[model samples]
Target: MQTVAFTQMKDGTTEEYQFLRSLEHRYIRSLPERLEGALQSLGSGLQGYQISRLEHSLQAATRAEADGADIDYIVAALLHDLGDELAPANHSQFAASILRPYVRAEVTWVVEMHGLFQMRYYAHHYGDNPDGYLAYQDHPWFVACCHFCERWDQAAFDPSYPTKPLAYFMPMLREVFSRTAFDPAILQAP
Candidate 1:
């Protein structure tokens, strides 16, 4: 296992930085497996729902795929709730972080904002304004996010929906997560 010689960033030579970058590159290659483990852990159920969190995620992905959504959309649907275990209040942002590097800005924005859009379904039942989503009614991706919640996330609690297993999505996960950390298409100057 090669390592950087410096203990602090300011002390590093180019050689040490290259070594660290190599290590990071190798580590990133295994991200799909790591994400899968995180998804599997959702089966433990922190707060109960009509279905386990893992099932809800699978159903969402399955729905997205069935609806003829592109691969990025399906993958986003699968990971949209990944942050619930660590940041339930801001899970959409957490999930969006994982997507931002690999996907289109629109896809990332949809993932980032789906939590608020989802609230429209039942927020009023808990005394929160269900129309809170109206705050973003004019944003470009607003309709896409609303459709995501309407067609996939909110409707995914069913236990007998014939949701695909996690293994079925492994290839897509690997392909999506294997991209370079920064996309040249998005980052390069026009």
Candidate 2:
């Protein structure tokens, strides 16, 4: 196992990002809230929002489990879109920055690629050949996600997933909430 230590704050500062260690610490801490925030944000578009992003994340995590991923991967699978709430853009990239602390490279890779893989699945659904999705599944990252999905904590954490009460994400989100990669600093408030 590998671990990185970085200080996590509700709002990040230049000092917080001084080293990879601090960055990693921030990532681990922010994970849960971002998970819930993303779900809530995505689900906001719905009427009753019955099938929330949180639900989707859980389902995706479940799917990852069926596919065979590690706990980290499962957590990644569950919370990959935590950033979709506001940006709906490269939120995973932002998530990567936030999760730098808790997740390993392998787990981070899976989350980073989730949006792309999701697009691949869309393409496959439209005769684009779901192979793209399958190919991702074949990758070690995907395998890790599948294995990770199998774990369920029901409270405190389920492999550090579905982050509850946006507060949790605050700590980790500070690490990766940057507006741009060229400039490594969080632009918005957490």
Candidate 3:
């Protein structure tokens, strides 16, 4: 069917719902391309940094790869700041939600909390509590989030870092996003 017959969700027939589901699955398969476009847009995002947001992201992923992190961590590093443009106020959570259905729980938790953990680097200068992340210190993934910020997210701003280009990460991004959505095996706690 070209379009659903129903104008509202409550009126959708079984066949129409199935058709919509097929369409959605096709759209889902294209996520990596959409994400590539989004990352490209970040080239013009928030200024003042020596590098573009895209560069920061590329650098973060490059560091993750160099450190021998698994695909989930590398992809997480690449996308950790994707919401910086549209959800600057809660970018971390926004990015995490995008990744929640694909990556491990620990990765999602770290990405969700990276913004708070990152405060330790600059919040004190703004009179905000740098120790804000201390509240989660006892959580299982607290150290992982701390390392995410300290080693990748917070440290990826250098203009001179030899970061891999976006093309270099496309395959990895495609691999991760192509995972069966919300697969229990993939999302299970690490």
Candidate 4:
């Protein structure tokens, strides 16, 4: 069928649901391409920085790789700021949600908390509490998040950094997004 017969969920048939599920699976398989497009769009995102948002992401990913991070960490670093254009107020959480289904819980948590941890650098200039991340200091992944912000996210804005191009990370991104979504073992918290 080209489309479902029902407009509402209460009226959907078994066959219709199966067809929709198949369509969804196909769309899911294309997520890596969509994500790459989104990252490319960041080239025109928020201005005023020495480098573009896409460059910042490339720098972060490059730093993570140079640090000997695993595939999950490298991918997470590359995407941590992806939501800046669409969800500027909560970009960290936005990126983390996208990564949650595929990467380990630690990487997801670090991405989620990077925004708060990043405040330690410039929030004081705006008269905001820079130490707000302290609230989560007792959490198991707190230090990880701090390290992520300090080493990858916040430090990636340099114009001179030898950032890798998007093509360099395509295979890693495809591999991560190719994983079965919401696999229990992958989502398990450490």
Q: Against the true structure, whose lDDT is highest?
A: 3
Question: Comparing 1 and 3 by lDDT, which wins?
Answer: 3
Cα lDDT, all candidates:
0.90, 0.51, 0.95, 0.94
Cα-based TM-score, every candidate: 0.93, 0.46, 0.97, 0.97
lDDT of 1 by residue, 1-190 (tens): 3666778889999887887788888899999999999999999867668789999999999999999998889999999999999998899999999988888888899999999888888898999988878999999888999899999999999998999999999899998887776686742422
Report the alpha-carbon TM-score of model 4 versus the true structure.
Answer: 0.97
Q: Write the per-residue lDDT of candidate 4 for residues 53-149, one digit (tens) a residue.
A: 9999999999999989999999999999999999999999999999999999999999998988998999999999999999998999988888788
* Order of the predicted models by lDDT, top scorer first: 3, 4, 1, 2
Query: Which residues of candidate 1, in runs, are more than 4 Å off?
Result: 184-190
Between the candidate structures 2 and 4, which one is better when assessed by lDDT? Answer: 4
- Per-residue CA lDDT of model 2 for 44-154, tens digit only, reads 553343355555556555655555655545556556666766546796676566555555666566566555555532465677654454566656567544333223212
Which 10-residue window in model 4 sums to the lowest lDDT?
Answer: 181-190
CA RMSD for every model? 2.1, 12.1, 1.0, 1.0
For TM-score, candidate 1 versus 3, the one ahead is 3
Cα shift from native, residue 65, model 3 (Å): 0.6
Count of clashing pairs, candidate 4:
0
Rank by TM-score, descending? 3, 4, 1, 2
Decide which is better by TM-score, 2 or 4.
4
Screening candidate 1 with a backbone cut-off below 3 angstroms (N, C-alpha, C), the clashing residue pairs are none
